[model samples]
Target: MRIATTILVMLATTLPAAAAGQAADHRVLPFTPSGQGDPQAVVCRAPQKLENAEGYGPEICLRNGIWILLTQDAKDLAADGRSVFKRPLVEEPHGNGPAEAVTCRKPPTITASRTWRGPVVCLENRVWASLYERGLTVTGDGRLVSTRMSGPATDPTGMPVIQTTPPPRDAPVIGGYYSPL
Candidate 1:
């Protein structure tokens, strides 16, 4: 009986250890969404669910840094009670270079609107309007100035779209892939 008891105790202790060893052997191998194996690789994670959605929405691959920015933006949007249509106001310096140097142009519909009270620069074929001209407006004079406290960036769901870590440069695109600029 004493031998049997000692055997039972030893079995209880070693059984789990043996089982764990076996489990570790079958551990999930690290692989990118592209099916490439890299132990040190940062694979894109799942995007955040908005407004208590049941599902995770979709599996999109984005850089971890971008994900961080998006997450912060989402949190800020939530706190500001602003609509997703509104974008956060970021301060930008007045360009001393030619107006044509700016690649993008503000849409005419936005510029023609009555609410558009900001400085509107009319390019040859494009109209450039400063969207960040919310709240208190001040001339930079080549210096940074504080702008309005606009809401944070948000997705259509009025929440920040959380993204996962970025994959290797050579990883093939799978599902919804976002390329960082």
Candidate 2:
């Protein structure tokens, strides 16, 4: 009886550890979405508008280093190549330069944003109205990033989007892939 009890206790602890170890082995599988990875596939707003640009006429919010390629269509984020950008991008100074290229990778994913950093220039096409106004923004357009907060602030949505980590270990990270945001 004493030996059986000890075995049961050991099984409870070692069993979980063994299972977790097996899970780690299969964790490296690349996460693939259901389509030809396209940035325009994501159709939604960042919720927090960091900067605004007036292209053509209407106002466009540059969120998470991405500019609102189409004010009417949030999913369609285009680089301001044809002088489409109207705001003072943090990347270009003086606001007058050729439309730079943005090395677009995978598809546009969605994640639970951690914090807001105002406005910033993460892409080249999102360069200043031209190529003269390049810099970073201090606002967050409701993008996703994993960060550790120190103080007690609040999400504009009155919800907890940013947190310690993502949903689960196997959850597909949103808003791009590695490196958080």
Candidate 3:
């Protein structure tokens, strides 16, 4: 009876530790995208740790339909040890008409520049714009000085520039014949 009681106690303590260890080694399941599926219908893996760099996280589904995983480098602890960070691809619609209307519920990501600093605003159409601060007084030589506008700036072009979304790294290539493993 004592032996059985000791076994139960050991299991009670060890099981929780084992379960925690398993949780720490979290990995995302594989995904196969359908040809004619909606872009919003896609899902990716969840991040394991909270200490992720900007624009890159584990199991994050990028706008290009790829799942990105940033794993720690077991080797090379000093130089190039961290994973690469990539911004999501965005495609803007083209028109001679007025600039596409955009609204932000939260502050957008700020991208710093030597000439001009601005915010990268993601629009409702999933398009992103790198807009310059409006009403900034510039020198005769074109250096930015001060701004009369407040909050985030607006696109100087009156039309926001859009970028094209790229495909996932592991996505199948067209016209290339290869055998599936």
Prediction-by-prediction clash tally = 1, 27, 1
Worst 10 contiguous positions by lDDT, candidate 1: 75-84
Cα RMSD for candidates in order: 28.3, 28.6, 24.7
Tens-digit per-residue lDDT, 1-181, candidate 3: 4454444334324433444434434332232111122432333233334353444233333211122111111000111112333234222222122233222222223344645423332232222122222334323333445444333222453433332344457977532333445
Misplaced by over 4 Å in model 1 are 1-45, 63-181
Please list all clashing residue pairs in model 1, or write none if there are none.
45-164
- Top candidate by lDDT: 1
lDDT of residue 93 for candidate 3: 23
Task: Judge candidate 3 against the unseen true structure and give its global Cα lDDT, from 0 to 1.
Answer: 0.30
What is candidate 2's lDDT per residue for 74-99, written digit by digit as tens? 12322321122223233223323334
lDDT of 1 by residue, 1-181 (tens): 4454444334334433444434433323121122123433333423334464464332233222322333323211111112121122333333333432222122222233353333322221111234233322234222224453323544554455444667568988543435587
* Model 3 spans with C-alpha error above 4 angstroms: 1-82, 88-115, 123-181
Q: Candidate 3: which pairs clash?
A: 90-163
Q: Per-residue error at 12 for model 2, in Å?
A: 62
Q: What C-alpha lDDT does candidate 1 achieve relative to the native structure?
A: 0.32
